[model samples]
Target: MTTVQEQPVSTGGTPSVVLHAAEGLHDLIDGHGDENDRTGRIAEPVVEALYDIGAIGVFTPRELGGAEMTPRQAMDLFRTLSYADPSTGWVTMAMGLATGLAGAFFGENAARELFATPRLGIAGQGTRPGRAVPVPGGHRISGEWSFASGIKHCTHLHTAALDAETGQTRFFIVPVEQVTFIENWDVLGLRGTGSIDYTLEDCFVPIEYSYPSLSTEPVTGGDLYRIGIGNFASINHGGWVLGVGRRVLDELAAVVRAKAGRPGAQTDTVAFAEHFADAEVRLRAAKALLYEVWEEIEATLARGAEIPLRLHTLNRVALHNATFSVAGIAQFAYTSAGTDALRRGTMQRLFRDVHGGTQHVSSSPLVMQSAGRELAGLEEGKRWVHFSLK
Candidate 1:
């Protein structure tokens, strides 16, 4: 048995894995976030500590030693963790989402072995294109992938490629030893994610270890998997943005309160009060709509009905809203704090981190454009990142 022990993890009603993680995020987890940022890698103690909270199991099925959280539950977990720290939250989000997708894409035995350890998590780049040549039982994988978040502490790494023989995209499940970490994670913010590049050299992945990215349905059959990829992908993006925005607000509030007694601080305080209130309203509206769409997705899935167009519509709108809202919040906080905000390890980092989120391809405004086009009866079935992620 793995050192990561089992505990009932729920979202409040039963103290599910996400809730457990929420309650278990203590000083160690909180303090190490900055350490991870400063060092450009997550500390071993922090990784191990996450195991205790079942962070890796959020989307993993119970049969595979995972928590099998509903897609929405997993999003809530990411949001809560981001509230503690965005770097840890990004790592957790990458691990959970990648592992979950692996579970769905890989066959039972392969999935089982991958999730054999209670705390096992995978990391790799999915964005870069690679080439796979046919071999005896599998394919030879050779490619360089970038932005592999949390690769330093991951058990395995994953990538997708163009199959030479069939011309299909194949998922390559590779042991960490076969891949080389590039030590190129230097960044302005969200520095702790270890979002670096990795290369595979003549790596042979067995047939069982590889699968067509779109050929299979999730082995862990559920309403969550039944929901289309577009709907499922929106939650985590919104959650991360929401949490970071909340943190900006929380930190700015505390700073404003601390400076309330200072000479000439009241003017800034009054301005901050108004901006903060406005920022909260926007953030909450985005969050409320996000969850409301999520609930609709669950209901639609539960009723065995086709996922609604509105689900994707709401998802795209919420994602864009959250990203912009967080950007606005960071700006307000920065102006409110002025020179102190410009200092290192201050509002500046949060500003960079939130803007960094906007840099994500998924958070791109193009997503909303495609969704809008689809809503207007245009060709959009497989034109977006959702198809590739699925």
Candidate 2:
């Protein structure tokens, strides 16, 4: 088996500063993960550390004083952070994506004003479009959105609303304080994410702060933004699953080693050894496939060409495989570790986190089926438009 010290797919650029910062916070985040889980929010100290390390700005444009990491670098950063703590990684992923995309979509004046802070954090739901009535200077939006991850620590929100007049969906950037947060984040895992429900009542968002939902054209960034939000989010989810999967396996390995000297250890069997090797290979294969897809997309974007239908379809399938395959690996680790994973500890938390990851819309059965349709050439002249073949 290959060593666990695998490096992320590299696309020749300056080394990632965000990756180093994520590494530095590993111990701190892991230590407080339980506490953060209990509180249904990331511990204050951990949140502060994320902001101080500039991890929340991983995806924002370089010109806007954010990291603007390449897709590969961003994936590595997410994997590193998630390996430390899944909840922490999930929150950071939501905030970073929302903030960066908002900046990319908004006009220069709005982006300059909104992202002026070095530690800008954003959260909101892009699916489940709300209502937006056209007004004189802007649109008055009113609706509720669910699973606004990282909303507890965010400064602004990026919500989707359907324009009543134009019938087109648009994303409105609003201050977090303007919305009423519904305290209902109770769930099976990643509790520290605080992905609660939120509502806006007649919130007026200026035209400059709103952009079409499908617009890949960025006003403040480079080619990365041109890939659209769906593809960008896939990178984050893919990296997160890989990290959590690695953690589960690594924890199980440590447990097996610690019990090796004990008499008749459950994991001492030859069958368990073979199964462990299989799990490791599965995860490694998934990671390799994910990176391969991203690397090709990176090369394409660098050449100023639009992403082809095949690449987009492959991105979805790659993420589906990464997520589900990791969950399978986690199941193996948990079962092989026996009662050790059942107790309240890192192993248990990781098992829960990995399963929680499997429920994300990005890897839902419908999305997978959609990808399959594309790959089978069953949807001729149809292209993927946000998890669907249309």
Candidate 3:
């Protein structure tokens, strides 16, 4: 069993201090190293620390008793948390994004009830394989939703289902008590995420707790909710990949320096040095691109304008850049670190984490296809990223 240790929160300081404390949480986990690989035991301390410092609600609306930080702030926090443990960062990003989406898409009553607590972690599945049958005043939802991350600690859940009559897909919020947590998240990477399945059986969902997928109604009340769902999805996962990439580069640099004076280093000294320099350049270029996209997103949010198509395009570009950077760094690290990186160390773990980061649906090939289709003026099929512009 992994030993869990919660970091104490510091009071009476600037917001940067709070952020610094949050970053420190990552360092603490990184110090644990391989002990963090145990499934279902790694993220408790980190999640507790985040709850203690109120970092989990960074994207929740202020009116709902959350900080309602901007997308940039949310991304920074995820990146910092991810440097320590990708599972912890994945769960945090998943919960934070779901909370923000709940506030944006759900009815006011549902939002109030869900965000009433200080840290309400949510797990959701977007695939609408479930069925929502209309009852008198609500809907009877029944189906098994897979890939519900952080379900063990979640108080609320968001699930997508299709109406049998009209064939319209909708999202529903259900309490923890109403669903059963199934242990289905056994994987080689991100094992600590506890992304288990939840079984829903004749769950009665109130009318207010459900909304059509891709809400067309304007999110009038909260500025945080006004942000489009596609934009949120694009930006949230970008931070996760960026953090993993950063870790890969850091580990590569350390390993290269350690092996610099070895006999193996003498054969192709100039070529190896060039490879290290090239990796650094590529990593820096990726960071610059991520920052440029972030600045554009911030500017758009600052102006209170709807998410333009260009923002989605930029998000796609940012994710692609980060993914390629991570792959490049991983290749260099694995090659330069020789056989040592194959052992259970920082580089090995970082390699797994970086690959896992790229496998996320948001960062997958579909995003690239969507961007290409949009650029070519071709009609993209139904997608989760499609939010109605009202």
C-alpha RMSD values across all candidates: 4.2, 6.3, 6.1
lDDT of 2 by residue, 1-390 (tens): 111122212121222666787798989999998998899999989999887777887887766667778788888988988998999999988888988787677777677777664457888999899999999999999999999989999888999999999899998989888999999988988888988999999999999989998988787768888898789767899989998998988999999998996788879999999999999999999999999999999999999898999999999989999998988888888898889989988998998888888888889899888888888888888877787888
TM for candidate 2 is: 0.95
Give the clashing pairs for model 3.
none
Predicted structure 1, TM vs. truth: 0.90
Clashes of 1: 5
TM-score of 3: 0.86
Q: Write one digit per residue (lDDT tens) for candidate 1, span 37-137.
A: 78987778878766666676676655455666775677778788887778888887787767766766566666666666545778776655699999898
Alpha-carbon lDDT of model 2? 0.85
- Alpha-carbon lDDT, every model: 0.72, 0.85, 0.69
Query: What tens digits encode model 3's per-residue C-alpha lDDT throughout 191-310?
Result: 667777888988998888887776734342255455555666656777776777777777777776776666767324888778878887887787678778778767876787766676
Give stretches of model 2 more than 4 Å off: 1-15
Q: Give the TM-score ranking, best first.
A: 2, 1, 3
Clashing residue pairs for model 2: none
Number of colliding residue pairs in each model: 5, 0, 0
The numbered model that scores best in lDDT is 2
Which numbered prediction scores highest in TM-score against the true structure?
A: 2
